[model samples]
Target: MSPRKPDADVPPGLLLVDKAPGMTSHDVVARARRVLSVRKVGHAGTLDPMATGLLILGVGAATRLLGLVGGHDKTYEATIRLGQTTVTDDREGETLTTTSAAGIDDDAVRAALAAQTGPLQQVPSSVSAVKVAGRRSYDRVRAGETVELAPRSVTVHRLEVRGITRPTPDLVDVDVTVDCTAGTYIRAIARDAGAALGVGGHLTALRRTASGPFDVTRAAPVEEAAAALAAGGGPGVLPLTEAAATVFPVRAVSTEEATALAYGQRITATGIAGPHAAVDPAGRLVALVEDAGATARVAVGFPPAS
Candidate 1:
């Protein structure tokens, strides 16, 4: 595919991608950049190559909104294998240790998972993308450096066990669905669960089910998205006006107000605790506004009429 020259006319919006397994999150962004012909494509969250499911990308000016998008809670379905631990806390990593899981029972598994639910501290995997001293932990690991990440608070709102299977006499696979706040790691959950049960554990599979307002059911396949855009059916980007309206509190403004706000003017606040979408009477988003006492000021403005 030919790279699209940077154009000011491309519409800004989000793309919900059903990422295929074995492709890194950056791979999808690179493909979207080529397919949509837009240079600015950013994703809200990262999914490891071994995982599949919903991945949200922002195109063009929507890249400015990715930080907000990334703040939303996420849901995942994963299989945790008890009996072995890995360097990465997932199947893709090298196995570091193994222990018999034959003596573990369902009741104990449920109890351990239940204990992990709600607010608690979690240590990310050693090979996670988290930065330490301005460098990625994974990069540090690959360079043969020892890395220890500090624990941070995370909330796992709900954890439901879907099923359990004994693939072998000494190995048990627990399938679970998790709803968690942003930054929660499913791999870490598997690792911790196994440690709690005195058996080493690692993630075998992971599939994200949802991220805030976006769900896997509504996501288009990455290949389909690329094909549709390349065929000129559309950029396949979700409309920005609808996206902003749905994701944030809305404040209707007149064309005059819209124009003023787009030019960095502040309008009267309506007591809405903002980051509210200030929309024109026609329902197009003019700016993201926040209330400050008597007025609302633009947090981000889409100029030239998006």
Candidate 2:
């Protein structure tokens, strides 16, 4: 059969992509736009060019949901190399210093990493995507400007040391799985841990395993998804209603309530929780709503696609 042509009928939805290394989050979105034939593609969170794994993308009107999705907790599998410090705090950066880490025992390594858990005021890597003085910190760094970013509050729910290996007498590599609130920097964790151990450190490898309720296991490789779309198959998108239900608490509403929400009017409070997905009898997502006194107000409304 011939491939499906891009048309207005493409549904608003979400795509779970298993991103490959060397592609930025924006690159994935651009590929999605070309294959899905819609210009409304947007990503929930960013994965660095050197990191790979689950990347959530919103399509069509679902772009409005990205903000909420980006704030959720995430999980990563990473390898931290003790004894090496780098400009970017990752292997992609130029080496700054190297110290002998052979003397650091597994117990000491665990202790240092344990200190990184719970609440933290982490200073992001100098090359992070964080904005500084209205420009990206990375951009400033590439321009030879020394940028000092203030520490930001973040939570590391868990840090499991998967294994510890000595690749050389001078270096130690620690494999770990991290569950952290949004904005927690794994690179910073490595840097801080190495600092505590009296050695330097940097991230060598990283991959996102999960984000919020979404897991990498459900993701399709970007190439595979795009190829399917180009071949006139389904874009493999999770419909907006299903996606919303997965991300937020569901509040089933009557047809009348759906109409009111679609019309920008408030409805009776669900009381289930604020930021719940309000769905109609037919299961179409009406809006993401929050309770205000006796009524629920739309945080983000999804009017029926015209």
Report the number of the highest-lDDT candidate: 2
User: What TM value does model 2 have?
Assistant: 0.93
Score each candidate by Cα lDDT.
0.87, 0.89
Off by over 4 Å in 1: 1-4, 226-236
Q: Give model 1's clash tally.
A: 0
* Candidate 1, pairs of clashing residues: none
Residue 297, model 2: Cα distance from true site in angstroms: 2.0
Off by over 4 Å in 2: 1-8, 226-236
lDDT of 1 by residue, 1-306 (tens): 998556434567778889999999999999887766677788999999999999988877778788888889999999999999999999999999999999999899888888889997999998999999999999999999999999999999999999999999999999999999999999999999999999989999999999998888878877676555445334334667766876898888999999889889888887867598888888788889998899989998887644
lDDT of 1 at 246: 60
C-alpha positional error of residue 187 in candidate 2 after TM-score superposition, expressed in Å: 0.5
